[model samples]
Target: MQLPLIDLVVFFVYLLGIILFGVSFSFKGRTSNDFQTGGGRLPAWALGMSIFATYVSSISFLALPGNAYQSNWNVFVFGISIPIAAYMAVRYFVPLYRSLRSESAYFYLEERFGPWARTYASVCYLLTQLARMGAIMYLLALPMHALLGWDVGLIIVVTGVSVILYSMLGGIEAVVWTDAVQAVLLIAGAIACIVVIFVSMPEGPAQVFSIAMENQKFSLGSMDLDFTTSTFWMVLVYGLFINLQNFGVDQSYVQRYVSARTDAEAKKSTLLGSLLYIPVSFLFLFIGTALYSFYQANPENLPAELQLSGNADKVFPHFIASELPLGLTGLLIASVFAAGMSTVSTSINSSATLLLSDHYQRYINPQISEKQSLRFLRIASLTMGGLSVLVGLAFNGVSSALEAWWALSSIFSGGILGLFFLGLILNKTKKPNVIPAMIVGVLAIAWVSLSPVLFSEGSIFRSQLHTNMTIVVGTMTIFLLGFLFTWLVQKENGKPIKSSSD
Candidate 1:
C-alpha cells in the first residue's frame, strides 16, 4: 500500500497532538495528589468527557460497529441502558463513594470489610485492566497493519511505551484532559469516515437502508425469543448489571470521581457521561450500517483478506485503506491510534494508583512520607506499564483479547459489587463475615465465567446470557449468597452486625 501525502499529514498531526497534551501536563504536576487525582481540581464537564472517553474504547470503535454489521443493530439498544446505569451511579454510588474520600476504590472496601477483601478486589481490578489494555492495543494496531503495513508488534510497543511515558509523567491530570481531546477526535473521525463512504457509495441513505432491510440485518433480534440467541433482553439486562458493577465498584471510574473538586461535580459528571453515550453510539452504529451498504454495492473493491474474514470488524479499516480519499484515511487511522492511546494511558495510570494506594502504601510501607510515596508511585507506574506491554505482545488476535478481558474482569467484579451492595443496600452481616463472603463470591463467579459451556449457545442454563450480562448475573448471585451466609454466621456467633452501608 503506497502512502499518500494527505494521509501522512493526518497521522503526524494525531500523534503530535497527544504527545503535546501530555507534555503540557508534565510541568503542572507538583505533588502525588496532583499526579493521582489532578489535586482534586477538575470541573464537572472535564470529568464527564474523561468518563465518556475512558468508557468508550477501541472495542466499541471496532467491535460494536462490526457487531452491528454482523449481529444486527440490536446491540445499539445497550446504549439506552447505559444512561440508566449512569443515573444510578450519580444518584447513589458517586455521592456515597465521594463521602468516603479514598483515592483507590478498594480502600473503601478495606474500611467497610477488611484487608483481605480489599486485596482480593484490587487484584481483580488490576488483572482485568491489564487484559483490557492489551486488547485495546491489539485492536488499534489492526487498522495500521492493514492500511500502512506497519508491524503490529512494533506498533503495540511504541503505543504502550508512549502512553506510559506521558501517563507516568502527568498521571490522572494528563489522562483526563487528553482523553477529552481524544473523545472529540474519535467522534469526528467516525463521522468523517461515514461521510466519505456515503459520498462514494452508488446510492444515498435511503438506498442503504433498503439494502439492510432486504437482508433482515438492521435489528435487535430475528423476532425470536429463543434462549439460544444473544437477544435484546439479554443485552439490556447484561448492560444494566455490568454498568452497575462499573459505576458501583470499578476503581478506575471511582478514581475519577475523587478527582472532582466537589461531590456534586462528581455526580454531575456521571450524569453527563450517561446522557452523551446515547447519541455517540447511535452515530457509530449508523456509520457501520452505512458501511455495510457500501460493501454490498461494491464487494469487488474490498481487500482480499477482509472478504475472507466474512466479518465486518475488518471492514472499517478496509474502507479506509482502499476507498477513502487520501487525507481522510489518515484522519481515521489517527482516530484509531487515539482510541488505543487514550484507553491504555488511563488504565495504566489508574492501575498504578491502585497498586500504590491499595497495595504498597498499605501493606509494604505504612510509615512512608509523601515524598517517599511519590517515588513509589513512579516505580509502580513503570512496572505496571511494562507488564501491560508484555500482555499486549501476548495478544495474538482480537478474539483472544476479548476472552482474556472478560475472564479477568469477572474474577473480582462480582465479589466487589456484591460486597458493596451488601454494604449499601443490605444490613445483614458483621464486618468479620466480609472476607469469607467475598472469597465465596469471587470463586463462584470465576467458576461460572471460565467454564466453556457457560457462554455457549447450546448450554441449557447459561446459553441464555450475553457475556456482559452473564458476568453481572454471576456477580449478583455471589453478592446475595455472601449476604445470606454472612447473616447466618453472624447470627450464630451472637455478633452485632453492621450494614454494608455502615
Candidate 2:
C-alpha cells in the first residue's frame, strides 16, 4: 500500500515546518550562554512539553506499542515509578542545579568531588546518548522503509541530516519549542491511531476491549516476585532506577533545568513533564492493545509479511500504510519522525554542551571567547550527529527495540547515579575516595550487565539475577564501598569524618 500524493505532501510539509521552525531560533542566540541554556528565559510549560517529547523518543512511539501488542501491559508498570523519580528531581536535583547555575550537569560533581568525577560521568553520559541517538534513528527509519520501500540507509541519512541542521542552527530554544510542537503531534498521532482502530472495528471499542481482555493482552505482566524473570516487580524496580537517572542525573533533563527561568519553574517543568508521561504512555500502550484486538478479529487484514514474520513492531506501521486515509497516514508518519527528532536533537545539543562545558572549558581553554565557544559547540553537535547516524545505520538483528535499548541503557549508565548519591548523602566521601568508588561501581555494573554472556551456561557466577537489578546493585556497591574506603582512610589518618556541610 503506497502513500497517496496528498500523504506525501503532508509528510514533506511537516518536515519542512520542523526545519524552518528550528532554524528560526538560530538567529536569536549569538553567544555560547544564549545557545546552551536559552539565556535562562524559556517558559516552564514549553520546557515541560519539550522534556516530555525528549523522554518519549521514537522508541516509545514504535517499540512501546509493539511491547503491548506482543505481550501484556506489565511493562506499563514503568510509568508508575516515573512520578516518584520526578518528585526527587524536583525536590533535590532541580534546586541543586539551579543554585549552581552551571551549563553542564556534571559541574556539581567537580565541586563535590573533583574534576575526575565530572569527566568520568560526562563520558558515560556521552556514550549512552550516542547509542540512544543511533537507536532512535534506526527506529524512525523502520516505518519509512516499510511505507515507501526506501532503503533504510537513505532514510537514516536524510532524516539524520535534517535533525543535525536544525539542532545546530536553533540551539536550545529551537530544540525546546520544536519539541513542544512534536509532543503535541506525538499525542495526536497516538489518539488518531486509536480512533482508527475503534472505527474500523465492526463491533467498535467495546468489542475491541472484550477481545483484548479475552486474549489477556491487558494483563499487567506477571505478578510473581521472581527477580530472574521480567515479572511486574522486576520491571517496576527497573523503571524506578532508570527514571532516577533520567530525571536526577541525565544531561538532557539537567540541561532543561538550566534552561528554565527559575528553580520553581524548573521543578514545575519536571513534575508536569513526568506526570503527563504516565497517561501519554498508556495511550501508546492502549494502541498496542487495540491493535492486537483489531488484528485478531480481522486476521485477513494483517500484512502478509507481518503475519508470516510475527513481528509486533511492524503491526502499527503496517496498519498505517494499508488502512489509514491519505492525509492521516502522513500525519502519523511525521509524528514518528517528530518523536525521533525531539530526542536526537536534544542528545546532539546536550552532548555538545557537555563536551564544551565539562572538558574544553574546564581543562583546555578557560578564557575562550563567546564566539569561539559557540563555534566549538556547533562543531561538536555536528560531529556527534554524524556519528549517531552511522551507529543508527549499523543497528541490525535486534529482536526487540525496547529490550535492546533497555539493555544498552543499563550497560552505559554504569551506576553514575551512585556517585551522585554519595556526594549528596555522605559527607565523609572525599575526592580521594571518589575515583575508587566509581571504579568499583563500573566494574560491578559491568559484571551484572555482562555476567550471563561471560559465564555461559552452567557457571556459578552466571546467577539468575535479573538485568533490571543491575543499576540498583551497581549503585549500592559504589556508595557502600566508597563510604567504607573513605571511613578507613580517615580513621587511619587519625582524622574524623566530615559532613557534606563541612
Candidate 3:
C-alpha cells in the first residue's frame, strides 16, 4: 500500500504518548468513584478541552473532511450553531446538572420526571452511544484498511481495546487529561495535513481559496425563509436544537462537567470548549475544501479504484496514503486514532456510569458496595465497548459516517431533550407525564416515518429533504405533541403550578 514509514513512527509516538499518559494517571485512581468521575476534581481547563475532544470525535477528524469533499462547504454552518448551544449549556444546563452532584446525568431525569424516565433516557443513550462508537470504529478503520492493508476486524479490535484499557484504568481523570492531549494531537494532525496540502499545491493558498470561492463552498445562504427547501432555517433551528440536546440534555457531555469540582468550574470548562470549537471546527472544514482543491488540481494522483466510486468521500484518505510524506502520514494516522480513542473512551465511561448508577445500582442492587459497583462499572465498560464494535461491523454499507451519526442522533435527541426541557421549564407536572409524552413522541415519529407514502410521485421535497432531516422533523413534531398534551392536561386539572427543581 506504500504507507509512509516516518509517518508511522511519529504516529506510534503519539499513540504511545496517549497510552503512557493514561498509565501514569492509573495509579492515582484506586477507587470506583475515582476511576469513573475522577472523584469530581477535574481541572476546568482540562475538562473544557476534553469536552471539545470528546465532542469532535473520529468522525469530525477524518470523516468530516471526506464528507465535505463531496458536499461542498455548506455543512460548515453546523459549527455556527455550536456557540449558541454552548451558551445555553454553560449558563443554564451545566450549573443545574452539576448542582445535583449525581454521577450519572440520567439521575436528573429520574429526579425531575421518574424512574421510568431515567430508564428510558439511559436506554436511549446506551443505544445512541453504542451506535456512535461502532460507527467511529468502522470509519476510523477505513484509512488503515485502505492505506496499510490491515484487516478491518483487527483494526476495530485494536482501536476498541486501546480505548477500553485507558478508560478502565485511569477513569474520568485520565480520560479528560488524555482527551486534552488527544485534542491537541487531533488538531495538530489536521493543521499539518492542511499545511502540507498547501505546500504541495502549485498555486498555493490564494489559488486554493479562489477555487473554493468559485465552487460556492464558502457560501451559507438560502435565507429565503423556506424551512422545507432551505438550509438556512434547517441549520439554524435543527443545528441549535441538536446542539442544545447534545450539550444541555445528553449525558455524554454532562459526564464531562459533572467530573469538575464545582459548578463554576464546570461552566468555565463548557464555555471554553464552546468558544474554541468555532475556530477548530472551521479549520477542519477548511481542510475538506482544501482537499477538494488538491484533487481537482491533480486528478491522476487519485487511485483508479476510488474514481470508480465516483465520490469525494474517498479523497481525503486517498491523499493521506499517496501524497503525504512518511512521517506526516504516521502523524495523520495517530491523529485519527487519537480522535477515535478520545470519543470511545468517553462513551465507555459514560455508558458504564449510566448502567452502574441508573440501572445496576438503582434496580439490580441498591445495597451494592462501592467496590462491587466499580467491578460492575468495568464490566459494563467492556460490554458496551464490545457491543459497539459488533454493531459497527454489522452495519458496513453506510455511506457517510457523519450522516449516519446525525441520522441516529436525530432519532432520540428531540424526545429526550423535550422531556428534559419540560422538567426544567414546564414546572406544572407532578405525574409521570414525560413517559406518556415520550410514548406519544415515539409513536408520532413512527407515524411520520410514513410520510414517504404521503408524497406523490412528482414531489420535489423528496429530493430536497434528506431522510435524516425527515427523522429530526418527525422527532420534533412528537416532542411538541407531548408538550401540548401535557399542557392541556395540566390546564384541565387547574391546580397551581409547582416550581422546577431549580
Candidate 4:
C-alpha cells in the first residue's frame, strides 16, 4: 500500500529534520580535529547513544526481524555475547585508545609493528566499512521501495547522496548528535511496532505469546555443538568473535572511544551502548515472533508475496505500509531510516577520518594545513559514500540481508582482530612473522568463505563450517599462526617469550 498524503508529509519532514540537524553543525568541521573528534568535548551520553545507534543498523531494523520471521531467534544469541565484549572493551581498549594522541585506530598497530602493520589493518577496516555502508544502504532502500514503489537502485542513489551530504558537511559531531536522535527513533519505532502487534492480536497480548510458543518461534536454535550449522553454540562463538572485533579493532568504534572527554565517560559510553542492544534486540526478534503469531491467527492477512522465503526481509516493512495508521506509519518508516542513516553516516565519517589520518597525512603530506586536511576529508567522505552506493546496487537480489552481511563482514574483516591481538598481547611483533601469518590467514578465510559459493551442492571440497565461522577461522589462524611464527623467530634469535607489558 502506498503512503497516504499525510504520511508522505510526515516522512519528508522527518528526513528534513535529520538533514537540518546535521547541517546545523556543518561549521564544526572547520578544522580536521573538530571534524574528526568534535574537539574531544562531546558528552558521554551523546557518544553512548551514537554508539548504540551504530549497533542497530538497518540490518537490525529490517534484516534481523526478517531472520526472526523466517527462522527463529538463533541469532539473538549474538546479543547475549555483547556484554562480555563490552566489558573487555571498557577494561582494555578505552584506556589504551584514550592514551593515544592519534585519531586513527591503527596508530597503535603502526607503533607496535611498523607502517606496514598500520596500512594492512587500515585497509581491512576501510574495506569492512565500505561493505558495511553498502549493506546498510541496500537495507535502507527496502522500506523506501516498499512505500513509494520507487526503483530500489534509484532509492539507493538518492539516499546515498543525502547521507553523503550530511556526513561531508557535519563530520563526527553531526554523526554523534544525529546518531543520538536516531537511536531514540530506533527504540521508539521498534516499541511502537511491538505495541501495535500486541494491540492487534485477536485474543490479546497473551495470545501472541501462546501462538509463538506453539510454533517454537522463540527457540534460540538447537542446543548442538555443530559448527557446520548455525546452532546456538556456533552463533555464540561467532558473536563473541565478531563483537570482539567490533569493540577491539573497528575504527568506527575506536573513533568514538577517543572522542570522549574522559576515560570514565568512554567506559560508561561503551557499557551503555553495548548493553542497550540486548533488550532492543529482544524487541526486534520478538516483533518477528509476534508477526508470525499475528499471521497464523489471521493467515488471510499475510500476502502471498511475503510468504516466499526470500521476501522475509520485507515482512516488517509491509506491516508498516499496510497495517499502521498514516502518521505512525511515517514515523516508523523514518525510524527504519534512522537505523540506516546513523550507521552509514558513521561509516562515511570514520572512513574519511582514516583516509586523512592513516593515509594522507601519514603518507602523502604530513605538514598539510588544517584547511587542506578538512577539504581532503570532505572529498574523501563523498568518494567513500559514492563507492558504497555502487555496492548497495550490487546487492540487488540477496536472499537474506543479515546472513549475507555477516558473511561479507567476516570476509572483509580479514582477521584484523587476530593481528591486533598479536600486537597488543605480544611484545616485539615481527613484520616478517605477521606477513606470513596474514597470508595464511587470508587464504584460510578465503577458502572458508568462498568454498560454499565456488563449489556445487554436495561438493566434497566445500567448507562444512557455517559462514559465521569465517571470522572465527580467520582470526584464530592469524593469531595462532602468528604467535607460533613469532615464538619460533624469537627463540631462534635467543630471546625470551614476552608478555603484553614487556
lDDT of each structure?
A: 0.77, 0.87, 0.77, 0.87
lDDT by residue (1-502, candidate 2, tens digit) is 4679998899999999999999998866367887899999999999999999999988888878988999889889999999889989998899989989898889988888888889988988999988899888887887779887888889889889999998898899889999999999999999999989999998877988999988899888788998888889998988898899899999999999989998889988998888899999999999999998999889999867786545888898988888888799999989998999999999999999999999899899999888899999999999999999988877844656545665677778857898888888764555547677777887888787788868987788885788789898888888888778877888999987676667
TM-score versus the correct structure, for each prediction: 0.92, 0.96, 0.91, 0.96
Report each candidate's C-alpha RMSD, comma-separated, in the order given.
Answer: 2.7, 1.9, 2.9, 1.7
Error of 2 at 44 (Å): 0.3
The 10-residue segment of model 2 with minimum total lDDT is: 396-405
Give the clashing pairs for model 4. Answer: none
Best-fitting candidate, scored by TM-score = 4
**Candidate 1 lowest-lDDT run of ten:** 461-470
Clashes of each: 4, 3, 4, 0
At residue 280, give the lDDT of candidate 1: 81
TM-score ranking of the models = 4, 2, 1, 3
Clashing pairs in 3: 6-327, 7-326, 7-327, 7-330
lDDT of 3 by residue, 334-368 (tens): 88788889889899889998998888889889999
lDDT of 4: 0.87
Query: Compared with the true structure, what per-residue lDDT tens digits does model 1 show for residues 76-109?
Result: 7677688788878888888877887878887766
Q: Which stretches of candidate 3 lie over 4 Å from their true place?
A: 228-230, 304-310, 397-406, 447-465, 470-479, 496-502
Query: lDDT score, residue 444, model 2?
Result: 80
